[model samples]
Target: MSYNMYLSALLMAATCCSLAISYLCWKRRELPIAISYGLGMLTGAFYTFGYAFEIVSTSLEHIRFWLRIEYMGIPFGTVLWFIMVLQYTGRQALVRKWLVATLMIVPTITFVSHHTNEWHHLFYKSMTLNYSEGFPLVTLVKGPLYKLHVYYSYSFFVVGMVLMIQMFIKEKLRMKKQVALMIIGSWGPYGFTLVYLSGVIYMPIDISPFGFIISGVFYMWGIYQFNMLRLAPLALQKVFASMQDAVIVFDLDNSLTSFNQSANRVIAGINNKWIGQPAVQVFSQYPVLLEKIKQGPFMEGKVQLAGHADEQFYNVHVSFINDKNQRPVGKMLLLSDVTDMVRSEITLLENARQLRELNTFKDKMFSVVAHDIRDPLAVLVNLMELMEEEMQTYGEDQQEIVNEMGQQIHNTFTLVESLLEWFRSQSGGMIFKPVERDLAQTIQINIRLLLVRIENKQIHIISEIPKDTFVYADKEMLDLIVRNLLSNAIKFTNFGGTIRLRADRSDHKVVVSVSDTGDGITSDQASMLLQEDYPVSSTGTAGEKGVGLGLTLCREFVHLNGGEIWFDSTPAQGSTFYFSIPTLSEASSKQSDSLRGGRA
Candidate 1:
């Protein structure tokens, strides 16, 4: 066999090996990195196969044709090699679409230039046939554009090698061997190309294609032996490092495997040295955290860390990691700093507790005072009645003075009663006991209690409420609300005015309204009447004294009964205060009765 024949055979064998490897890799083309490696191998095969044909071609024309075909793969193969390395190292984000296109542009231009080289001589300055080593070899002097292509190819090769080397150094022990093989595979063609470019060999033949055969063999070994294509590189490091919450991962045996950047900040004394150590030993300084881990795989709680003047709070969440078969393999703990939220909640709760205590004390004082004065006031009222009976024994001036004193005492007693009721409601001293009660009956009772005031004002009381209407509310609360509203209406209305009590029932609730045709309130007064903190003590149309506690108590009772109260009023047009309470549904009433019977 001729020397050229031997070279052709060698190149053919290399091409077949590369094509076979490319086919095997293409079978698992779902993996992007694997596809890139396969493409590089295929391109290398093309270059070698075309060069083999070019070497044995009898005519210069045939050799030139084969050389142009070879140009198609030469530049593209180098770029693909760089891309494969980048993808394998989990740095594929750097190989953007535009960057890949940019890399291809030069190779595309080179291929076109080579095809039309005879016209411009931009790819090859001159081509000649030389008889050396008893075989025909095509020799060419490179053009300026060809040198540029060389530099471009060499840059990619060098960069790819550098990236692979860096990855090998940084990769874990399990991955080091695979990365090392990849580096060796990549270096073969690059080393030979460097040797050719440096003029280290005087041979007319370029041996870079032979070097690619060695590269293909190594790559195949990595694919089949190490399962390199199947294993995904550690790509979550970027995401893990950027997390704001501290994250720690531990193996099933309770040994710390990994942690994020924020872990050290959250757990003082934490460092990289903690990796691969037992979590209990590593977190020994943080007894709370260590004890929590010992509890179980799932834990959620808060921890307080001692600080200079206060304390830092953190909310921790722990969960177990499961394998594909749903077996527990590890656990991950996430700690989120909640110092601000904790402090705010604590301060708010303390203030609320203090306010509640003060309100309770105030209620107790009022209750005690009212309890003491109520009996004496009743005695005084009885004594006044007896004095009125003996009024004929006195002069007209003495009789008038007696009547005035009785009226003052009555008003003072009413004010004190309203104040006591309001204090009990505010301090949560009143117990709520809701039962089925007739709405009309409740209204009638309140109207009877306020009959004296209604007669004094000469106000006509009209009731439009149905006799069968029922509601679900505490009886005492309902009584107080009705009494206060009726009393206010009678006080505000002039003599001969009308006070209307109406109720409208829907499927779910009953709306009761007390509307009076009296000297009404302004918008501001109406708004202030419902506010608990606003002090509103305006005199009635008849110059009656008020402490402004009636309406405040009414609003509180209405809300506590799962109801709402609002008023519509216009200056000099009278006011209508409306409140809604849930109606007694037959199903709910029956259920309550059944429960009561069962309890009894």
Candidate 2:
């Protein structure tokens, strides 16, 4: 191949590269910047393609023909690049139709003047073939119109460079590398154009096409490394400015670097003039918020700011912004207005306090009435028992009537006692004081207390509790739990039915069970049995009535003493209620023994 053929091959290589870059940018043509950039690259492809053929052309006519083709891309390339710069630097709004048409005026004039230069001699004074450097080169004398085009191109280059430099300086730290690569890519063409104008090197071909190849390579690198086109400054700024929350950025040295418009409402007197100022000074009015920001890389808390009418609340989050290597570069403070949520929470607390006071008053009044009713019922029960004894000589009917009346009065008294206990527990009037006690003894005492009713039904009582069994629990609570379970078992058991009591030690707790061969509840009843809101009221197998308050009190006292209660039941079969409480450790048993001895 000759020297001219080699030069043509170089230009063709650049043409192919520019075409590829144009295709890449065109794929993302949805963005304004990408559209402009792709058009610029397409023009670059045309410029290089024309130069490739022009470089090898031997005839002056063919050279002039290819020069006209070169003008097809050359005049408009710089204007497209300037438009791309405007979009890339968050200035897309300035790229209006009128501004674009105004910028195109000079390039369009240059293209028209160049094509008509033969008639007017305005674009080029003269054109001739020069056989210098062993190759044919088309050389044109300087014309007034050509000089105007050069100055216009150079002006666009300077303005684009200035805009890109300003963006590089003001962009976030995370985006600096991306902007730097873009600026480097743009400089390739500008630098080569300057060298070509300065006559720094003698060559038969213009070297600006090769400069585009450099730009294409750098731009491709930026696209892959930094996602340059995908994350433009225009979109970034719009999202940042449109956020409802206040966002403030600080450097590693705790100096204010950037903030959004919403931040103005949060930080008093904050503005662009505060950039580079120490964060402590900038946030001096909000010492609590500042202290939280300086404490750690990540934190979240509530803060109150003075408002026009009432205080405003904000949920502030501080997090460190990290670099590619996971190193902390700076801190970002995000303040979200939570004034409504805070106010709602305060209102809820006040309502809850008032509700609790009303509930306490209601419980006390109910207890007072229950207590007053129980005394009269108890006195009547005692009087009926005395009357039954005194009227034993009267008749069997009279004695039976007295016994029936006494039983009715006794049931009422028992119900009143259960009501008082329930109210006391609900109102927190009952204190929980756990102590070591023998489990077997306590269970035996409750069984004996309910023995009269148990025998009336002829239900067999079985005790499987070991004599040495002991637990750590409130003495009154334990007695109540045992009494209620035994009473319920007795109440539900049929004639000659079996009621068994068992206590077994497991882990740190003792499992106690009260099972009765009585009417078993259904699955739905068992599920809702323990729920406080769904109280179970039913008649016993012996036609006895109850409100199920005993079981509820048992569950409450069990949980208060750090224990649990559950039941297993089958329809038409028997049911077993189980509860677990802490067993007395060796240390606790010894302490109880010593205390009893000291009291003695």
Candidate 3:
């Protein structure tokens, strides 16, 4: 065969090899790296085939036509190769649309300039047919655009090689051999091109296409022998290494496959040396953790390590690691430190216990004082009343003094009774028994109980509540709430002032209110009345003494019966205290049953 035929035959072989490898990669083109690599190989095949035809062409016109065809692939193949390397190395984020377009601009310019070289002489300044080594080859004086294309192409290849080398170095234990193959494949063609461009090796024909054939062979080996495409470098190692939680992965045989940097810090004596060892044997020192892992593939709880001087709390979570097919291929253990959270909860519980104890002590002291003073005060009131009857026989002034003493004793006794009731409620000595009761009847009963005070104050009491108005509430709590509110109104109201008791109904509940025309409380006092921490007490309009416990007890009882109490008050104007109790309905009755059942 002639020399041109021989060169053509060699280029044809390289073209056939590139096409075969491209076809194999195309079959797995679903992967981004595979698609990029396949397209690159296909472009190489096109360029090689075109060069082969150019080698045997007899005329300049035919040679130039083949060169234009070759230019189509030469400019784009290098960019594709660079993108493929990025994808393989888990740096595909760099391959943005605008960035790819920017990289392609010079290559596009070169291709267009080469096609119109005859007009502008921007790709090739001169061309000649040379018969050397028994082949007809096209020799050219490259133009400025061709030199620019060369620099751009070499830059892309160098960047790709650098990225591949980085992966090979960083991923020494895992996927190292595969990365090595890719690096070798990428470097071979680039090295050959450098030699050809530098004029270091004198040859009639450019051998870069043959170097690409060698690269394709190495790439094929990486794909078939090492499974490089399927197990391309992933970012998992970097992610796990930086994680705060300790993570350990086990294989199907329960052998420790891998662990992160945090795992080493969390578990003493654990390191890369423990990899591939049976997890149970490796963690034998912590038998609880090992046994739990052996019992089932899943376990999670707070675990305390024994070696530390201070208690170390970890939230241990173990779960099966499944493959893409949802088949369990391994198990993962995650140890998250929760010492702070556990300690906070413990502190909160202790504080709550202490608070309850303090409240109990306070309630006991109040109960004892009220119990001890009641009898003595009762005797004093009786003695004063008897003295007042006798003094009426002496003079009006002496009788008035006796009457004032009797009023003071009565006020003290009333205060003692209220304190005793408050103590019983706080100490849980009082039982809560809710039933359907007439709201109006409950108010009337409280009214009768406070009749003496009402008569003394000369306050007119009006009831706007309907006779049949019923509510679901604890009867005793309701009575206590009404009595306190009425007594407060009577004590604060001026003589001849009016006090109104009314009930309003909504879909869910009935609101009972006590509105008084009296010297109302200040805004700050109203706000502090229901707060146990800040007790509010003041003398009433008629100099009636109070300790502020009545409103506090009213709030507690209302809440116990699933009700709420609030007041609208204006200083020196009047105050209206409102409490809501569930209205008697089918829904309310059922809810009451549920609450009772839960308590029982």
Candidate 4:
């Protein structure tokens, strides 16, 4: 083989290296730095391969064909390298879409000028084979556009070199070696290209393609040895240093490796000097944290630290850090300040305890007062009844005055009884013990108890509930519901007005209703009454007073018994209040099914 053939073989070998590195780097294309560098290497392979073919060509036509092939990689190589430098140095944010397009303009013009050089002669003034060198080689008389392409390519190499140099000067101690290798690798290509362009070396070949072999070797070493592109320490370091959480790194030996600025500020006795110290020694003041770190690779818990002024709380999280091979190399502990959250929870717990105590005291006070006043009010009502019987012997006006006094005493007695019942239900003193009972009999019993009031109002009542209409409910709660609803109906009905009590079965439930023919409530009043909270009560037709506790108690009891209550009121016409309870047979069947399910 001749000297030119040996050079061609060397170029082919370099092309193989560039292609291999391109494939390896492209595998990690998720990283912008890796992908851009990979593309640069791929174009380098194309340029080197075309140069190998160009150097061995015997004819001018074959030489020109190889030259055009070289242009395919030449236009893209430097632009891609410049972009890779920007990303590798953590300046990728400056690579906007418009900026990239603008950079491509000169390369695009260079490619077109070279390919159509036969028409305009702008890329080369003349092209011929120089046989004087023993082997035929393509020799070109440089054109004006050719110089423009040379200058443009040199500009990118210069900029990329400056960026890599700047990064080397500022990089961390451990990363300095990697950056140094990168600088040397990138500078090799520029130096070789300059030597060829300046005619400093008498070489048959361009000599620039060999520079890519240097780049591939150094870049491959940095990738596998220093984990340059895979780890991306330059980009991640910026984010790690700016975190709000205090982060501490530990090696496999449990020695402190590094810590962020936040760790230095928040943790006492933590400083750069503590690096390489055992975790136990560094965390001597925080025994709990040290113990947790020793337990395993992963841990999470809350720790309280005593500050100079007050106590501070932090949520500590520890996780293992794995290398590229997924082997555990170190662990990181992240401490996030949660003092405000902890203090708020503590304050809420204290307030809740105080609220519970206040509720218990209020319930006790209501019980004592209701009991003391209710007994006396009952005795007073009985005495007034005796007085009414004797009042017939007095004058007409004196009898009227006695009757009014008796009505006031009765109203007071009724209010006291309601207050006692309301307080008991609210305090959970009323336990629900449901049993099957005849619902019609329950209604009749409440009516008999309120017979006197019904007679006084001269209201006519119709019972539509059939006999043996049974339902499952707490007996006392059921009686209270029937009595309150019946009394409300009687109070609202006009003199000699009609009142109806009805009951019907609906889907395993018995629905009961008490209706009255009186002036119905407005929409606003209906909304207020339906709410579970304390609602405003109005005076009845007979001047009877209330506080709406009866409706609230009814809703609570209905929900506890697995039932529902509702009402329908037509303005200026009348109102009907309805409530539903489970039927006796249905309730028994459900209880039996529940027992069977539990056994199964």
- Looking at model 1, report the run of 10 residues with the lowest lDDT sum: 227-236
Task: Give one digit per residue, the lDDT tens place, for model 4 in 436-460.
Answer: 9998899889889999999998989
Residue 462 Cα positional deviation in candidate 4, in Å, after optimal superposition: 40
Task: Mark the 10 consecutive residues where model 2 has the least summed lDDT.
Answer: 229-238
Candidates 2 and 4 compared by TM-score, better number: 4
What would the per-residue lDDT of candidate 3 be over residues 1-600, giving only the tens digit for each residue? 676677678778888878887886766543456678888888888788998898788888899999988888888999988887776665655767898899889888987899899999978999998876565678899999999999889888877888778867866454577778878887766777788888987967777776776787787777666645232211135676688998877654566656677887667888644544677776877776787666656656567755643566788878876544565556777889876676666556545654564466467546645654555476666767777676677545565556666666765766678776655554554434568998888888889988998998889999999998988877767888999999889988999999998889876789888999987878777667766533646788878876456776687678666678988988778999998888667445554343333221
lDDT of every predicted structure (CA atoms): 0.74, 0.75, 0.74, 0.75
Give candidate 2 misplaced runs (Cα > 4 Å).
Answer: 19-38, 58-69, 83-97, 112-121, 125-136, 141-143, 162-184, 220-362, 371-600
Supply the TM-score for candidate 3. 0.45
User: In model 4, which regions exceed 4 Å deviation?
Assistant: 3-6, 131-134, 229-321, 325-600
* Pick by TM-score: 3 or 4, better one: 4
**Candidate whose TM-score is highest:** 4
Model 1 lDDT, residue 247, Cα: 83
Superposed Cα deviation of residue 199, candidate 1 (Å): 3.0
Predictions: Cα RMSD each: 15.9, 20.2, 15.8, 17.1
After aligning candidate 3 to the native by TM-score, how far in Å is the CA of 122 from where it should be? Answer: 3.3
TM-scores of the models, in the order given: 0.45, 0.45, 0.45, 0.50
